[model samples]
Target: MSDDATPDATSERAAALGLTSPAAEEGAAGPVRFAVVGSGWRAEFFLRMAVLMPERFAVVGVVSRTAERGAEVTARWGTPTFRTVGELLAATDPELVVVSVPWDVTPVVTRELVEAGTPVLAETPPAPDAAGLRTLWEQVGASGLVQVAEHSPVMPAHAARHRLLQDGAIGQVTSVQISSTHMYHAVAVIRRLLGAGFEPVRITAQRFAAPLMNPRTRAGWTGDRDPVEASTILALLDLGEGRSAVYDFTDNQWHNPLRADRLLVRGSHGELLDDRVTRWLDGETTIDSPLVRSQSGIGQDLDGYDLQHLSFEGQVVYRNPFVGARLSDDDIAVATLLDRTGAWVRGQGEPPYPLAEGSQDHLISLAVEEAAGTGQPITTEREAWAG
Candidate 1:
């Protein structure tokens, strides 16, 4: 959940629908019911959260178009499943609807929930394109509903990074470089750091593709489109100061798999590099650097995950903040969002990842795609990420 304000209308609407418990009405203590709209890989994570933190989340119902898939999840999780939105909602009337279905199909589920006025926490890339996003905006406007994106950057990793930047750990007003084969996460990071709101500007590029599906997933999976892997470059507009984030996308490493994430911040005094988020001072000294990861997790990252040990001031080593953090990436993110959501339920706060910010993520990715396709820099001149 983002730290954005939830207008009174939105709040009242959410409250009226019994979407959640209001502070004054907390006497009737029952778990807040939630429905998972898709039963794919991501759906499992949301379901996992429900089991991990049963006090906070409940899997009231699940919706999957395919009976086989739905039954698989229902059997494994011991929850009811349905084949359609109407059936799921009619059965559970969940307060929060978690949409993890296909990008293009998400709008359909979103419309149903928003029309029913259920608070939504849709999966990443809520829409396939700007046009699809517009459908959601229109639906919400037509009926006034609350929804949030499930993008991780809106959580602590980004919140802490923003706070630290504001705290002057690396000093402000500079530039940055980021590379990713995944466009959405990269754009989300840039938007969060740049403090720009959602809304893609007129992008100037084209897209490239190759053959898409494999035996695991038939053509029905990817709209029968090719190009499993892609490369993209994103640049910010109206760059005066503050920060600039450069983005890169590469072909998905099917046979040649490599997970590459690097970040470098150029400051007036020094720089910081990579996921370690290490800081440098006076061009030759290190301030705070943590030793990187060495353990491997199965099926966690497409490419096995490892955080390389980082060095500071040419000698001193730092401790791993995550050594005892006891939080998975998904756990850290969704948990924080739930914290904000709980606050909203109690009338203490508002939604974390708002529609506008989610749209900004979409636009940024679109801009990057356009740029990569056309071989020109697309400019999001003033598309501020409203939240």
Candidate 2:
């Protein structure tokens, strides 16, 4: 269960619903009951998380269009599958639904579920473009039933960095330099860290081309012997109030070790370069600290391998809630989003990342691509969904 989840409430709800939950059986809160739509590669993240953390999450069913796909998923994940959302809902009630599908299909699936009154955690780029976003907003934006799985903000290192900023460690962040994830995902982290909060802004962007070796993936390394031409994009965002961000990324940077991840956050009193932090301590003294990481379950450790937490200056900034799950950094972040979403649905916590924030993230991302293509600065304006 999430740190914020109430054990008694979950168990009581499960018992009242006549559902046999693992948590309830263990005399604790039951896991969050949710379903997944679209049985595909990305859907594996939800499946794996449920498998790894059964006490925290439960999969009611998976929505697949074909019996063949449904059988495949069932064989691998031990979860029943349905051909449609209505079929799944008719048999069982899930508090949340996760939509993982192609870019264009997201808004349609999410709209159907939201109109059906199911809370949804839609995949990134909630819609493919601004027009679709506007249409989605007009249809169900005010329903308060959608959250985007933009997980970068909750990634361990990034979460620690945001905590520092939130705690005034940097004395009010002024600028953010990110060459981390690409496009919408990167924009989400940038806006969250800078505390931009859907503010209107302008973006000027450019792209450069180069050749490099694109190495590994979740599957494994691509042993291909040739270098591929890669495109690099740089975007400057004016988020108003002297709060700005520079987004730089190259194609396949997420898995390309040739291009290391880079982040620089600047504030009134100091800056953080990667893990190193340099800031003014008392107007007259300058101090430096490093974001230290802890890991276990390696070598002689019998605890099983996983990330523990991130600390700075003798303080734990971000701790992994799924330590025994053996999840990767990205998986941990996504799981955190799922856990938080469950808590939000139960009215136990704040909305994880609302649809408005996701829309704004993608809106800026679309502008970045447009600016890169047009060689001009693009200004962001208030949308009908801005709140």
Each prediction's TM-score versus the true structure: 0.69, 0.91
- Candidate 2, superposed: residue stretches over 4 Å from native: 1-29, 217-219
Can you give the lDDT of residue 371 in candidate 1?
Answer: 72
Query: Worst lDDT window (10 residues) for model 2?
Result: 1-10
Name the best candidate (by lDDT): 2
Error of 2 at 9 (Å): 24
lDDT per residue (tens digit) for residues 139-229 in model 2: 9888999999999888999999999989988798999999978888999889888888767889999999988887776577988667889
lDDT of each residue in 198-309, candidate 1, tens digit only = 4334444444454433322322333333345444344443334444566545454222223345656555544556534446566577766542334443366443342222
lDDT of each: 0.57, 0.85
